[model samples]
Target: MLQSIRSASQHWLGKIVLSVIFTFLIAGVAIFGVEEFFRGGSSSTVVTVGKTPISAEEVRTAYQNQLQRYQAQMKRTLTPDQARAMGLERQVLAQLVTEAALDQKTTDLGLAVSDAAVLRAIQDEPSFKNANGTFDRTLFYQTLQRAGLNEPMFVREQRSVIARLQLADSIVSELPVPQAVREAVHRYSTERRAAAVLSLAPSAAGEIPAPTDEELTAYYDNNKASYRAPEYRSLNLLVLEPEALAKPEEVTEEDARTAYQANQSRFGKPERRTIQQISFPDEAAAKEARARIESGEEPFEAVAAARGLDPKQLDLGTLAKSELFDPAVGNAAFALEQGKVSEPVKGRFGTVLLRVTAIEPGSIKPFEEVKDEVRKEVALRRVRESGFDKAQDAIEDARAAAKPLAEIAKERGLTLATIPAVDAQGNDPSGQSVTGIPDKETTLPAAFRADVGNDTEALRTKSGGAIWYDVVKIDPSREKTLAEVRDAVVQGWTKAETDRRLVAKSKELTERLEKGEAIETLAQETGLPLKEVTEIGRSQSKDDLSPEIVERIFTTPVGKAASAPSGDGRAVFRVTAATMPAFVPGTTTDGQLVNSLRTALADDVLGEFISEVQKSAGVKVNQTAFRRALGGEY
Candidate 1:
């Protein structure tokens, strides 16, 4: 049976029959019962689920496609090591394993799609449709060719995909979500609270004494990692943008004039008219509509309204003659006086009558008036066309001769900038942002990964320019001595001590309030101002009270007190009121919450189903073959 299946797959009609039968027979004994059915046996298989063998080539192809997608997103090519570090191979393998499990289950259930259904799907694909919105055979074939697939392979794959989709839809489609669950989520999210909060400033810590030398030393020692400097690199950058290389003095009068003539349309505005139109099925209907408007039997807007057209549908906004879709309509529209309707005109689509509402006259600046601007424009264009290539060659030649970037810049008239010291985040040793780094996103990462005195590769800019960089010096990160950062350390210790004292003070105050003392009485006694916040939800955060305080407010019962860290000090808040609005079904917010919960539940159910299927079918991985497929050593 297996030999006959293979033989049948060689013919066009037989291939379709094979596909229809493929899912039913794929789990038969001929394939799964024999361990050596694969061409290269177990060595070529990365993973096997039930009767399905996921080959090394399949893994490699999937991995490469994923890598290409990542590269396209980052806008830069990534090395194999970088992809490996991202764990893309593991993600791809896991996804393939899940898909194989699904496929196995589908086959085990004898799921199959007919050839006519697959053909209908192909014809329905929008990518294979022509301008007339019908299937184009040539377009379908061309698209398949571009995707590196033929008719038979695509049909077979599509058949399998549809079958797997059927299995998944049966498991998860339109799963019911309970109303009680929706109400619970809505209540939790919409619950609001009111709290009376007393602010505690750092000074409330009562003038924290200065730390002694022993204390400061111990503090610095305990938090040495915070005082360590980041690794910094000194760099020289050569940027080749159009403006930097443009030399307006080099542009002659004749050249400027030629450029001005070539781009005259860009330097002037064209005539534009605001027009309205009403179309008819034939010229006679258009003529009748025009005569009615001309004879004052009805206004132009009334005529439009009679045809069930709104003002927006009738009015074509201001457009130039070239911008109009139909030349005949455009000509008639432009010829009409403002507020006057045109005669019946036959346009490309149909017959129409046009009304010109307003017109703006065109104007162009004289050559002499814009000569200086034209010269600069020409000079920039000239440099932009070939400046980067020339600069790159000069830099390469200078590097081969061991000349410094500054010297190369002076000789070749390129823009060279020197950054004395910069961290990986483009900050200096003092933590000040270092400005004027061209293409910093690309340059900084490359610079940090480079060795000192080595020429880094040229990076492309968004504006068709290029930047080359060289790491000049490296400043290794090291822990700072207490003396080197004594001021910063003293400040840190003071803040920490102040916060500790403030927390203690807040706790003491909170305990008093919890013990039946009125919050207002305590606030007045402590000489602190108390503010009442109302309608604060779980997600609310204010200037004085942070989200942490808001969370504590919601968690505390009414009339109960809790303490949370605020900005610089701590806040002691007493919950005054709590409210949970009644959940109204089918409200926008309720509907959104219901949809979100339903989606999450559906995903969980589908995931569990797939996992169970995988367990029942059994999954085995050849670690050596998997690693080899990912370009790793066995």
Candidate 2:
């Protein structure tokens, strides 16, 4: 059954529908980008799914939507060339063809959505709701208008969408996993294995002696391409940030006290109580219930149950002083100690009988404990609210005059620093980040755009400050001279030789184990970190033991030796025991496990089912029309 599902879903359409588009539609919101074509002239059909034509206009809209989505997600505008490079045009066209094919198949199967169902689907869309929580006709039309869609076009699209969903639901609902498959999955999930593992660390490689000059020279020559230095630029930076401008001395004790007093919610909260109560029709009945609890004739829960109120229905959980709806009941309840019953108190709802189950005492941070932090927060907020005026002023002056940023720094009382040769990623030759450069989020793109000899226009930063930079020098990337990276090259060569030796050592150890040498005895002889694991389920993961070793232990037969690769070298393990728990029928735990496995099996089957439908219906694409709509020849 699993193999059949796997075979069915191997098609491209199945992969796109099950793995890719489902996520794209849910989170990324795939839109129709190339909608402009639909408004003007009639174009050639780009694809045909059965008798339905997916016009060039629809394909164009999808491509445009995809382009805008990419730009928004990446936070960088794509040039026309970049957009073409992504192959989004083909991806979007194929998606539209899949939708058309599904719609065609659903229509042939008579799975049409009724008019009322379409109305419900549209109104249920939270986008069409107003503050009143009902569909607003004005908003409905205005939103579609903003989307470059008319009522007719949008309604048609929604109709197709709802019908396609109906088709998908039927496919998912029809597939079922066999009983044997379910049992097989249960045994796979619950089975455990035991093994003793001999860990081979880099130390096991045994202090590999220094390499010969000929070997070192050959290693460097063969790997020269990987030794090239990245392209780097020298930069002069001028920056202003809100936190940097906030002087600690400017903040006084009075300011911190005032901030702490005004923003009490941030520092501490009042005491909260968890309470339960039952409303009564009259004061007499409420008083009677409270009296019964006070006399121990009945507990609060007993009284609540007698009144047809469930414990959960009566529980209000924990709430702060101001959260209560009735001040009379709240004041009375807060005054009572835990396990004490409050007297009947008249509230907005009715006469209520209340009991406090628990209380969390309120407390405030001592002034001295928070003084320094409070003062700094107040001063920084004040500076940020002013929009970092000093930085803005200095940046405007530099941009208007096109003067070097370093000169502007002196005039504005700001610090200016030069970052020696650093790569486009802001890493210096040593591969550490270049210090004193502006934050990478704002600087990397701007630095790339700036002319080599000219200062950039002031770029806005998240701190509401501005930064200016100049590209002082550009060094094209190239292979570094051997003298420049001799240490790094030697380090790399040593590590590679060590790994090779480790593999050989691990193989030798495996051979000994296969020859009846106990793993624990071998560990003491070789000085490796030795350990044993028993009765651990296949799905269990361990931090100390590598998952690769656990997997290999389960796959190897009892008494057989196997080796699995680790970060340093390898784990040579011998399986001692294994077991598969028999699948018991009708138990709730077993049923739940079987159901979970069936859900996955159903999805695989459904994906295969959809692909078969698409193929049987037949899909064709018009190369010329598709190329024209996408604005390219593929």
Candidate 3:
């Protein structure tokens, strides 16, 4: 099932990196001198997936894209060294394997997309549309060009993406969230109780009787596995942030002036034009209307009204020249002498006559206009460069004084801030960017271990950053104290109790049902609420079931009784129900069925093709090469 799901999602790799990553990296393209195209290098062979050979070039492109995504999102640098450590190169090669495996499968199955369908899909994409809601060929071409893709490459990529989606939909559509499963999920997601939960906190119980020497010995013997600590290594780390290089002292008035002057365009507004338009179905109509205006007998609006047009209806007043239609359209309008009407101008939306009512000239903004912003920028840069030493000294003094980070910040007039929980993978809150610094070449901080004590002095970093960590006190491994294991033990105990109670209850209920006890009566006796859920289908929301209790009810035979453990040791059940999901009457004949059948047929035969490729290709993975490229041991 997992392999099928993974194969189904083959498109994820080529779906374009997230826009957030793109935004950050695209902006700094000039800073790193990163080339978009694959540069020629001594070609190296990588693992081949099926019959298709995965080239060093392919792996490099994928790796580079991954690096850019990390850097752009994290606003840090990523070096090739760390990539080698994570087996990233091998991972890319694996992706190529998976893709080739699936593509061959697709080809062998004879599944196909028509040129007409591809064209329609392209037209439907919102990114390719003009303001008038039709595909703009020039804009579409330009966008692809910027992304370093050509028409054929883009189309081929799209074909694979669509094919992959078809494959996924085939599997997912068949596996309807079974009504029973849906009910279970719904109950789990939505059911809430007003019970006053009192935590049996071990802390509130006080220093547990310093376990008698005998008790400690017994526990160690019974659960020796709990006492082993995970292997850990302490490493010196270096961190370099943008602010580390910025120094307020180094930002002279002259320097500020120069920066302000050099980036003058950033402070200036684009040239704007206030314009109006009138459209006609064809150029002949537009020309005829223009003749009436030149003859002085008909007003533009009057002639338009007579021709069954609402002259004011299409008024797009005061649009910035850049915002007005396309460049061809806007240029035509701007070039026309003020108050003079343009000749029939052909555009993607048809022909139109444009009149420029006003022109707002573009001008360089005075430094005074953006002085406060410049000052802030200048100050920040300077502080980054000069304040590092002060920050370092402050940290050292704080350690000696045993003062808190807040106290040190207070004295230094700098803010002390906290970053929220980062995961073991180094992911941020969004569960992306395995390294907290997205752009930087860093891996998970191997220094952070479960054993690292809380409230320790700031751990200095190699990147010029420091972490004044108070490890959030997670449950320790077996090697830690017994008190740390108490919660898990109690949780296990409760679950076991619930299961035992539920099994007995189910037996009792089944017996009573055989003897004809009313379901309502049983509910009343047991103090369990009896409620009827209607239209329960394969797609039922899990919230309605409360901890998966509904699965037993739905799966039970209609005339039989069943009970399941639910919510904190409570047992829940139903005696019988006549209604259960079979099939919607017309769905078998629906177009959806045809599509599903096509997909299933394709997937079934795909494995044979992959096997054939495997037989043909002599594939070997150079684990050492991969590890070296990624920068660490495989």
Candidate 3 lDDT, 1-634, residue by residue in tens: 1121123232332222122122223332221122411122222555444445556555556766666665566555544545555445444554555555556656666767778877876777777787766788988897777666788977876676567556544443443333454444345434322111111112222232344546555555566474544332222222334354455555567777787887765788766776667778999999998888878877766765775656555456666565775677888977888777788889768888777778788787888787666766787766656766676766677657766555666665555444344544454534454333321223334235324443443433444455444343333223755565655444444444445545655566657765777767776675555565544443254434543455554565565655554454434344344443343423543345545443444444343333344334434444444444444433
Candidate 3 similarity to native, TM-score: 0.53
Model 2 regions lying over 4 Å from their true place: 1-20, 23-166, 183-207, 240-264, 271-308, 321-401, 411-413, 424-426, 437-442, 445-468, 508-545, 554-559, 566-576, 584-590, 605-634
lDDT of 2 by residue, 40-104 (tens): 22248877777888887787787777777776776655555455566566567656756777788
Model 3 C-alpha RMSD vs. true structure (Å) is: 12.0
Q: Sort the predicted structures by lDDT, highest score first.
A: 1, 2, 3
Number of backbone collisions per candidate, in order? Answer: 0, 7, 56
Candidate that beats the other on TM-score, 1 or 3, i.e. the better one: 1
The better candidate by TM-score, 1 or 2, is 1
Point out where model 1 deviates above 4 Å: 1-171, 247-272, 275-312, 320-355, 358-375, 382-387, 397-403, 584-592, 603-634
Q: Which prediction has the highest TM-score against the true structure?
A: 1
User: What digit string (tens of lDDT, one per residue) describes model 1 on residues 1-634?
Assistant: 1112133233332333333233223332232233432223277898898889899998888777777777777776665546666667766666676668778888889898999988887787677775335678878788777666788977887787667667766776667779998877877888888889999988899987899999999999999999998899999988877777788999999999999888776678978999898878898888898898989999999999988887788888898887785789878887889999898888766678889888999887889989899999988888877774686687777778888778878887776899999999999988899998977877898889889877566776656677778898898999888889999999999999998899899999999999999989998999987999888887767645798898888788999998998888788989998888898888898777866776666666665676577668876777778788877732
Q: What TM-score does model 2 achieve against the real structure?
A: 0.62
What TM-score does candidate 1 get on C-alpha atoms? 0.72
lDDT value, residue 301 of candidate 3: 69
Flag clash pairs in model 1.
none
Residue 427, candidate 1: C-alpha displacement in angstroms: 2.2
